[model samples]
Target: MTSTDELLVKEITVSRQSSGEERRLALHQIYVQVLERQPYAFERKQLAKIEADFLRNKIGVKRFLRELGHSEVYLNAFYYNSSNPKFIELCFKHFIGRAPSDQAEMRRYCDILMRQGVRDMITALLDSEDYSRHFGCFTVPHAWAEASYPSPRTFWETEVLLHELHGRRGWIVPTMVWHDLQLNCDGGSCRLPEPSLSSAPSSRTAAVISGSEALHQVLSTMGPQDLAAFAATLSTAERDKLRHLLMQSVQ
Candidate 1:
């Protein structure tokens, strides 16, 4: 072939390779955004169809996400398969990269589920201005576990915060199984009394300190439920200060 013809062929080959790469990247992102967890054959097939349509311009990225959010696959996995409160929690984690910061936010979504239905609840989340501002259309939203905090908590603590909002409703009340557990029981059952503190220690109690110090003392003795309740009362800034104070004490 002539030099110009050879150059044209090389250009076409490069174009095709670039196109393939872009398509692959798009498909991977779609998989994560649409089905971050395990999927059955039918769910996988539907995602595949959606991906193909997205690539062909038959659907835009926003519509693609909306469709997946409203799909039976998503509903079954996040909504029907779990508690309604849990489903609401998952929606915030998956679509907004953070947990609901307040009980009111969670209650609002639960209200949607009760009044409108699952599909509309999903629609409300995906179509919200907050989702658009944070994640845009095609990006895969994930928990902000690695997010930089002035004072960060441990990994498990972060995970706990994701689903542990206080005053949240719709979760089944847990049975008090421990009420009947014998201390010397042999069927792998045991009950340990929880610790409690009637007063703060004298060393720090005599001196006036910032509320963070007092919070640290209360937090040091808190069970899971108490800790969650305390967390619910704090603003983001107060939470950060409390975490910082706790870490300082640990060090």
Candidate 2:
């Protein structure tokens, strides 16, 4: 079995010239990528049947991948420990190989996960048009979208979304939400405006948030509606400055 460290050294790829054993090796890499790390011995035991079927050529990579995604073992590793939003982010990284293409795409998947459960959610992504075009059944999925992000704002979110995920799931706030909500300040702190009519913020609703971890906890678990509300608060000029700052910060 490949170590998790070795599996993550590079994206899993099956070169056009490969056959037989090389293709088998590609299967090992696929498991690492999907699980976001090496599987525990018990986890491997859970997946033994699926892996056996794949080894026997009884199923294509697509079917093998689908079973893995919907497996309870996978849910325990990636989804159960993560916040809903973080799980969605990881899903894009794991299966589709990028952050959500747009807010609409993100919201749609979130809805699927909430309404229909993991099986349907994973199925939607694997069966999507883009998956069919680039990966088909045999090709290993890679982060091809890393070269071209769909939105300028999403580029900043690449900071957290595209990197190696923390082993401790749900430990950090998602940068995807924070990117839009970042307070305009020279100091390294954050604040959010209240949805109130008075000039002063409600004592309960406002406070000085310091450090990324603190801020993440303070604003933890925002949804699609919360994002829209946050965007509405930004002035046109603030939005432009944010765009400029976000790009600069990444560089």
Candidate 3:
């Protein structure tokens, strides 16, 4: 195995001795320590490997939730359905109140969170009556994490925000397209065509439309014909609105 793989094995072996809750906390601490020490060396694939191994062996789903509840990781609190709701809440409160640096670590946490059932809970929190009044005052770690992962539910929340806050203003074209076509596609693996700003308005619009349409086509090819049909049913105005929003989403 590679050195990275060996390190992951070592981490898991050390983590195996802890109780379920302790194991979860230990894993998070390991991630934090690794990132602190290596900085750029720890990338997404390594993190994913660690999580897959954790899920496969050291902790079953229930135990994972239990650990999340007991750990100091506050995101666990937002992930309310876990085994230890009260403790998770406390951790969330502590993290929110104390560690500003935790935000940068969100992308790492997001991978694991996306696998757990916490995504919906976080989404509910974001959509709650309290979110707007408090979100601005709160620190959301990284914009990319807030925009990308943690769960399918969180992704939907991001989509809602894109439509409501960004879309309404007509500034929501390329960025939205980028998210829909690229960033949100398979953990940012989707390749996008280059934008051609030098083209005339008609050509540019056509190009954008083609790229936008390709996103749906790709999704359709992924076995969700119903969604593709639903996408097709969008009215001209609705399509225009979405296109405007998505186009703004590109980088």
Candidate 4:
């Protein structure tokens, strides 16, 4: 796995002019990096169409991942097998490359999933500012637990949760349940440290006024449903800014 520092050094992408064998190799790498599947597993006809579309350059890494997030293979492996909280937690790791800092974060995505179904839920995640800031349309997502967690316990627990906790391994505990097990004590005998605001190393301290590609794409589409889905992806401050813009437009 490439360190975030290494990704900063050289963000990787497959060239359009690469040979067929090179394209196959690139696809294999994506399967391993994004899905955590065996290197050659993509060869056996899972998501063959998406693989071909990627090979044919019909979609970028971002869109390919968006498709993967809602696809049957992914849903079966991550979503259907685990509870909703656990599914959302896995999406954070797979799509955004981190454990959700807390349950409020999980609730947001979980709500998206419940109301909008897996496709729109995935759209919100892939279109998020977090995904753009970390991976953009090029590089594969990788664990940020090493550099991002606020304290030693957070780092340790998240590393364990992301890598070790899995339903296939019969570790059926969901995200916060696993966390609570670690943080909670019998008879209220312990005072667990409050998770710090600074803990989300990848999160912005404040919302910016500039519209993201998400907003711009909505503007381009000019469709009400796209507008709504795009809006769901915004932070509260961002939504406020957007609401103000819309209100002013009508006035």
TM-score of each: 0.52, 0.64, 0.24, 0.60
Candidate 1, pairs of clashing residues = none
Give the clash count for each candidate: 0, 0, 21, 0
Per lDDT, the best of the predicted structures is: 2
Decide which is better by TM-score, 2 or 3. Answer: 2
Off by over 4 Å in 3: 1-14, 19-21, 24-203, 206-210, 222-225, 239-251
User: 124-187 in candidate 1: lDDT tens per residue?
Assistant: 9988876776556654444443443212322232254333333232222111111111111122
Off by over 4 Å in 2: 1-19, 145-148, 167-172, 183-251
Per-prediction CA RMSD (Å) = 15.1, 11.0, 17.5, 13.6
lDDT of 3 by residue, 1-251 (tens): 12211222222222334455655544554344222222133343434544565644554322333333333342321222222221122222222211112222332333334455454444433343432333322222112233224455334433333233211212212223344433222221223444456769776665556556644433322224433433444456655655664564353
Clashes of 1: 0
lDDT score, residue 180, model 2?
48
Model 4: per-residue Cα lDDT at residue 133:
79
User: By how many angstroms RMSD does model 1 differ from the true structure?
Assistant: 15.1
Q: At residue 156, give the lDDT of candidate 3.
A: 44
Clashing pairs in 4: none
Which model is ahead, 3 or 4, in terms of lDDT?
Answer: 4
lDDT of each candidate versus the true structure: 0.49, 0.61, 0.35, 0.56
